[model samples]
Target chain A: MNARVTPQDSALIRSARFRKEREADWRRLEDLVEKAEKNGLQNMDFAGTRDLASLYRQATTSLAIAREISLDKALLEYLEALTARAYLSVYAPQERLGGLVGRFITKSAPQAMRRSWFYILLGFLCMGLGALAGYLLYLENASWFYVFMPPEMAGGRGPDSTTAFLRSVIYDDDHSSSGLGAFATYLFSHNTRIAIFVFGLGVFACAPAFLLTFYNGLILGAFYALHVDRGLGWDLGGWLSIHGVTELSAICIACGGGMQLGMAVLFPGRNTRKEALRLAGKDAVKLAIVAAIMLVAAAILEGFFRQTVQDMWTRYLIGWTVGFGWLAWFMLGGRARQ
Target chain B: MRSPAADVRKAQRLARKDRRAERGRAASTILPPEGVPLNLPVASIGVRLAAQIADVLITTVAAVCLVILFSALELTRPQTIMAIAMLLFFVIRVPYYILSELAWNGQTLGKRFLKIKVVAHNGGSLSTHALVLRNLMKEAEIFLPGTLLLTLDQESPVASWIALAWVAMAFAIPLMNPYRQRLGDILAGTHVIHLPQPILLKDLAGEAKPMTAAKPGAKGFAFLAHQLDHYGAFELQTLETLLRAQDKFMSPDVHARNRRTVATIVEKIRQKIGFADPIPPARAVEFLRSFYNAQRAHLEQRQLFGDKRADKHHAADETPQ
Candidate 1:
């Protein structure tokens, strides 16, 4: 009835129907292929859409070519190529500045914006307060300076003259031994941990807050008097300045960490202490990580290089340069990246 | 007509093309072209962004609330830690969906309520593996340079560069064209589709119940109906066309237009029926069949007795001339 449908005839009819239906798919393939050709691919990664895009290109091209002629192996190869090509296009590197800016925002937003003011105020306050305490301690009992100064430096001064001991140790480079260097490194690390803990614990506003700040001040006072008694006060100051700047700054940073923690507990903002502490801990932890990095760098300079460089003038130059350099770095260079 | 042999050769060539075409058609449903002009329903980007923001907000709020609650309760350190741990569970573990996919899903709870869903590379369901992979890959989305590689000179390569790495990773998946699923989805072997909620005639008639069955026969109708109901109107329209093309209710129609018309009519019936609880298509049809059988019995009885039955006989006999 339908034109003497034979097996072959039926097959032919079926084929015709299939071809008619597949026209849209073939056209879509062509469009994707054309788009791929226009936008060539370069770099490829496994995580994104690199392979799918390539295969799409190859498939589209093969379909396009195959549609023109009959099925051919060569045409399939073309399809493969087209697919790879299309996949590669999407995988190619994205725009550069756009990504950097995004990273800058993500990293910098919390640290600088949220905690900057508190750190600045605390750092300056500690320095000024420590210097005043040191002056008072020196004026009260000059020999008491030995309490703050390292035992080796204070003990070296004999009955001949306290000034001689101070000069020989603080101002004089001969006494700066490698053992002392190692000791300083160990002390710095221990002190750093304490500082970090203090800063971390500052949220309570009671014991940790007082202990961390007062300990720093008392140490500076004792060390200042020991040097002043030796009559090499300014010289010792210059020598300490080189690596001390970074080292002390790191301590302040640790305090900032503590302050961050302590504030969370004390103020609690709209949050309860537990919630506030946990929430604050995220940013505070990151700050601590940054502080650790700064501390380590300071340790390297203090332990290995600063101890070895001994000329008072040389030490002063190096100390001031390193100290000022670190100040500039923390205050400005870091902020600019964000 | 042309030579029978020529017709056969032409038919064979055409058949090969048709087979290829069938595969192509299969692939189309798998991955439609991105941003085609067709009124393909997609959840708005704004809605998706909003949903994501809400998820983050909820997560934050929960964390804060738990911490506060613990402090108020004077909970022990371990308990506080546990509360914090639970609050940050998603950030620490399942980062992807909460950040991007959740947003892509929709803007508001209302949109979610509306049953609109989002899919990657045209609307396809994500497989389980893909669900995990996509979420895991979000680490790169946050940390890697998403748009950085654009300005780098092709001549020089940067190591430890995240953007390039991400590109390579994405490219590895769906390389065969048209399927366009990411690697995660490919491994997971799943696709996303709007959950259907189609209403059956019986449902419209207020006599439908949620029936469960294992096979695709009568039970699958509810499944299909549910799938239709979940998709937006546009997706439902496409699905209707496909179903009509592969109609199983009766004999296949030779005319494409007629087949399409029937599908359109069925969809119209579904809209009009408005079932609060949808019934499966097979069961609905089955119910209709039983009703017809009863009607026939009544008519036959009437004919044998005193009533006229000529119209019923004619209607039954008029199948194939």
Candidate 2:
């Protein structure tokens, strides 16, 4: 209703609309460009807007005459405006902040998270179950508990299997060098990898991922419960958390990917669920790639740092520091600058 | 490019035609006609491009921030905890956007900042389920044959070529529309629109002046008679109030008082103008436009100067010039 149609006003809606209209024309354009490139047309200079419009019009008219055109007048006009807007972006650029802010606001904050929460929680719950299952399996044969802890702790001890097991989990045989650092590093990486698996499974992936997650969870729970029963829970908890924070975040990312896929499959909006699932699966893979990096970092931390620190207080300090550091970095750093 | 002069002339003619019609209607009857909203203005190429750029920058920053937060936990902690944290963030944050845009009329934080809204072509907000469904459709929006088309060879199979063709078409739907749309919009039967301020009385006055000068068609006269009969005196007051207090106008509820006031005025106007003929809404608009312009001119002139004094001053001003 406004008396003007400024090129500026039509920018945002153009790309999507252009894709819809002239589907054939766009394909043709891409084809022509590609063909031209193949034929060494890269350096060929083209004319201005007038030429492009005429060419486009000719193509569109031919399609219309052949009764092959699908777009209506209203849609066509919309597409034209959008196309004009798109052309401007290539020639005269805008600030990057605008683009960043737009994506953060539109794509990341709410909708993406909502679509992916279920698998995350499921992954968490599965880990606990996994830990518990491991515990029960250990209890079935008490003599085998030492074997479950690791190989090194049992090396020197002829009796006192419990002592041997603790040694293997927390320290080395030499006692000159504590294994706490190594164990911590291993735990961080191991947990993160497990988390990744749980998350990346998606719906089909989610099932196995969840099972693995639950199995790990149960093992952790049972191991801790056993330690508490022996009055070593505090030491264990402090020792474990040093790298747990980062490792856990990685796992959650995996679960997030899985959830996205599951949701896509379960609720495909305009398309069939199968199609949705396929798309979600690809995105999940992208997510998993990122998750893998986190898992690796967690592994290094667990293997090196956690196992080396012996004093419970010192361990707690390091654990809290890393945990809070990550928290502050993610939640506060970007926002504080803004 | 099209001739700038031609475009300008065409726009002016359209404006003039609208103005004259408005004046004609106002002169014929005391009652004013209901106003129609203007078409949504298209977004410029620059803004659309900015929107894309914004999306990428925002996601990267957010991801970086999330990574930093996850780094703080002690190495000794169970790996599962980090896993949980990641899962929580991803699940809660992602879909919230898609749902909000679909349900609240395409207004996520970014869209809201951009000042655009989505609605059904028929003009209504989407429901929660529809919003949920739309969000889920991101799979298609993000993936689909567009990617495949981009990668395929020129001499691909007919089916492959056809698929590429289909996605290409889907993508263009929005551009072809006054309201830019893509395939999802077509499938969902929705449109995006820009909301602007209401039209002013001056603009209306300018539009109406010339229409009343033309010879009246029988259809126009008949419509005028209908307006006078259905809405007469009271409709005038309501319209005047609307125009005078345009800045402060709120959508008043249709209670008996308002309904009766408007109805009585409409009836009076119809009786006075006697526009009872079968003319379309577009043609009928001409009469009201002319009437509005004449009325506006008369009122402005009266307010601007006292009759004799104003004329003597005008003569003096002309003499000095």
Candidate 3:
């Protein structure tokens, strides 16, 4: 009994000494990580941050050693949680407002738009085909207008409406400018919602997204067909062009972004489908931001310019210029430095 | 704005205290970039649903408030007021989800209340790209379908049924998965894990009498070195649990049962290790305490020499005698 007792006494003493030697470093790391989590890491000085990193490393090392040598359950759990909190602190995303906004605008957004060129073109193609179908169907039968557009959306401007009424509706500049704020807000909210919806539904292999964009184009064509029958086709073009170029393109690009998500899943190449989707998601988010910005721009133009401007020539020129500018921006915006 | 801190803090402390006393239940591991597998418990399905409900309530309240505020403004056109009221929650939800998660490190106000958090599934940093992707998916998966079902255009039972199916499918995704990830979580490569409130209790050493302590009416057991080698860390943890639980709060019946259990454990240990002397009834507790301290130290020494006995199986694997 005397011989057995001696080794146990010494073992207990050694374990206590080991813990006492390293406990200070672990405590310091725990304090720093907690402070950084509650506040921000920027509040700490350079020396403090350096010490935190060093202490975190030491704690991890101590934890590894403790696992092998210590039977203390409390110490083991404390070390495990401490390292996890430290890992989160050390690797947490730290985005500065200025750099993020600048980078998103000048780099990421434009680059994503450029990358999604094929999907965007495909979105436009679907829209174009739907437009052609609606236009031909309307020309074949004027009553097809009701079939293409619901009365609520058409706002009583249908095949049954007089040409005079249609023309007056397009050139209704006498509407109160005070209501422009409300109009812009409504349009921005409405279009942005549809854009986001189209983008989000793209994950089901692009069919849903493509079909929705096509459906939107059908409405556009049916409306134009009604004006054509009234011989106000070019006038309708001028009226729509002011905001249509921006709004339509924004919606299509959103479709493109969604389709990219679909494509990533459908054809993940070598990477697993989830990894591919995540990468596509990164690009798609940028495109969604672009779509949102364009929709806002469209809302502003429609409310302030379309409601007030009466000149057809000015309208056509502004529309074409903006369209070309959007095209050029996507093609070359982020590549100037490169 | 309501403080979830005080109440949750208490519950969290008790939960962690229970965790420290109990043996590990093999909580799922998160492999951080440091290559260390941190065992964090994933939030349960009920908890996640409750959190979502809380979020929905908050957002709906905000929406109703917006409706009141917008109507109070008395906009001349009813169209403007109608538009605002109709889509308030839809608009409010997206920004509320994205911005709060971004600002508060992947915790929405609801998540903060429940003490669960969105962590990267691949153990990477919680990126803004991921947060945006996930929350955007939330609209397609949950909000749109949920709203449609709630509105339930009664004329068309078919559309209502479709919306019902969509909502069911959205909810079922999380239930079917190992990580309880909804469609958004799957897309974003993120999962919600329960945030542990780890409070290290004072070690068993604090409870155990020192080897030199000469207690009244009893002498401590002198455990042999080879006898200490009979068990492993797994057994030691179980012993730690047994030693930490004092008889203070136990009911009279429970206290009697615990004493019997401890006596049985002492008999088992004495026979397994071939200890010669008989420990009296008064000294059984002390005998177990000193034995635990000595065995834990012996195990630690062996572990220090890179011979970790994870469980009782180490004897069959290592000592061939």
Candidate 4:
């Protein structure tokens, strides 16, 4: 036997002793983790899950002791990693897909939109300004329409194009079924892209979002001008009314969501910029989703109803009814007890 | 003597101090609550960037393959092609991130490669809601502006500048934050941390010999049952770490330094435990070794009886007055 045991010897002895006592449980826990990692926690039976939870608690206790006492670096590291993995496995939040979708639609999305009404209004004002500008510019000189609207987007619907051609494009069902489907897809994708752009660009202090929203409105106004200059304003209104109410509203709401994010960054009240942004994002993202939903509704209307409904009055009636329905839903949807 | 309540309070205070000191040492990383007891190290910006680059490269390759595939299909209508393109972007690319993160437990392929994982800031498991929110935000943060400028409007100087600005802001947010959380991470209450390095257990055969031989009735300092109860596994492990460091310092001067350290530890432990035995400076190491053995045996026995102590403080609280 050694005459005098050095602290080094003592420590080594203590570690050995400690490890010997705990190694069995640690090994058991490690084996469980390995099994869970391979086959997932679902593979474990009720008994296995219970055992895992008990073992995890024990391991966590062991980790706390190891950390507090400053155990051997390797053992400490092992416990830390093991406990973290176990915690993740044990406490993972599981939600059903249907339930999640239901919650989003019924409660979260509408609540978020209602909360950010100021931004939505601002988005509408910007779009309105853009539309007015586009209208005035195109009215003064038809050449301005070319600057704002790309040829591909115009699709031969320019100032130079005859009134009959423009009216036919909106009202006539001469195009083949496949051709209509393609047109609907094109219109839906184009509008969806703009909606996404308005929402995404809001990160840059809402400037780009405002510009994009206004640009969308400008295109709409220029198109309106093209029809109005040729005494087809009422016919164009009926055509646009079929889908424009839902589509434009969706765009405005998406832009509003973007503006909310920008507002959070610019005016963080009592919270850090990050905290503000995060809180704002909870609502903003919901509005964007709601906008996307509206876009889909609009796409269906634009695709099917706009092409089929030749009577201007019926189109107006359908458009106004759908628009009013959406307005009521937003204003009253998901309201909590006062 | 001290009253039992006083003893409990002192032990609790010491445990709290230890935790505070640990937190102070790792101030750069955000720690969960004391109840969780996790010590996660935040992944550095460089590692995060590398992981992102890898992901982007993978997605770009996939996008290219898709474009080629679609081109080969030779769909007659431009609308059909545009529709396919939109579907590819929204369905394939977006869901790739969401589903992968969900399936892989907060690690994408790139994150897995770098040994970094997204974890909940609250020390809970990653929730589905968080996964969906974060991945959905990715479109706004990185992909949307990128696609708009690079593919949609390469000719527009204004659009290009706006995209560049957006990208710059996206990158800058994480850099400015202490936790290195991007917008999505902040919104979702998640952050990426480097996975702990794998632990390789060393050969403890030689170390085990002395411990086994110096068992009960061995030539070492004797401890009363109460003294043994004063500490738990925590103190035992601390003593072990101190002893293990001796092999690193082989010089005589270092040996002298180790003795001083050993004596200091012995005195502190003796006072804390209220041990009245007078231990010689030369036999400090022997006393610690004997105490450690007795404590380990006591803890193991208690564990078998379903009365396990979490640490020294916990052991103290369990001691009969």
The estimated TM-scores of all candidates read 0.36, 0.35, 0.86, 0.72
Candidate with maximal TM-score = 3
- Give candidate 1's error at residue B295 in angstroms: 35
Q: What would the per-residue lDDT of candidate 1 be over residues A246-326, giving only the tens digit for each residue?
A: 667667766766576667767888976655765555454445545555676666666566557776688778766776765
Error of 3 at A164 (Å): 2.5
lDDT of 3 by residue, A52-86 (tens): 88887776677777766778887788888888778
Point out the worst 10-residue segment of candidate 2 chain A by lDDT. A85-94
Order the candidate numbers by TM-score, best to worst: 3, 4, 1, 2
Candidate 3: residue pairs that collide: none
Q: Ten consecutive residues with minimal summed lDDT in candidate 2 chain B? A: B29-38
- Per-residue lDDT over B1-321 for candidate 3, one digit per residue giving the tens place of the 0 to 100 score: 658898899899999888753532333577776666777777878998788889999998999897787668765356565555555776688789988787767788899899888888788888877787788778778777776776787788977876777778887888776677887787788988877665666666644655336455445567778888789889988887887785358998998898898889989999999998887766677777788788887887787777888988897886666
lDDT of each: 0.46, 0.46, 0.78, 0.75
Candidate 1 regions exceeding 4 Å error are A1-115, A143-161, A171-190, A334-338, B1-321
In candidate 4, how many Å is residue A187 off?
Answer: 6.0
In model 2, the runs with Cα more than 4 Å from the true position are A1-118, A132-165, A168-193, A225-231, A266-271, A278-290, A307-310, A325-338, B1-321
Q: Candidate 3 chain B: minimum summed lDDT over ten consecutive residues — where?
A: B19-28
lDDT of 1 at B245: 42
Q: What is the C-alpha lDDT profile of model 2 across A1-338, one tens digit per residue?
A: 11243453243132222333444554444344333323322233464333334444443343332222211222333333333222211112112335644654444433433444565556556665566665676556544445444334234332244744764665432432223334333543346545543553455434655555565555465566566555677867776776665666667667777667667766788987545755565445445544555565565666566556667778778777876764453344324233
Stretches > 4 Å off in candidate 3: A1-14, A173-181, A188-193, A303-305, B1-27, B59-79, B86-93, B206-218, B247-254, B304-307, B313-321
The candidates score, on chain A by TM-score, as follows 0.59, 0.54, 0.92, 0.88
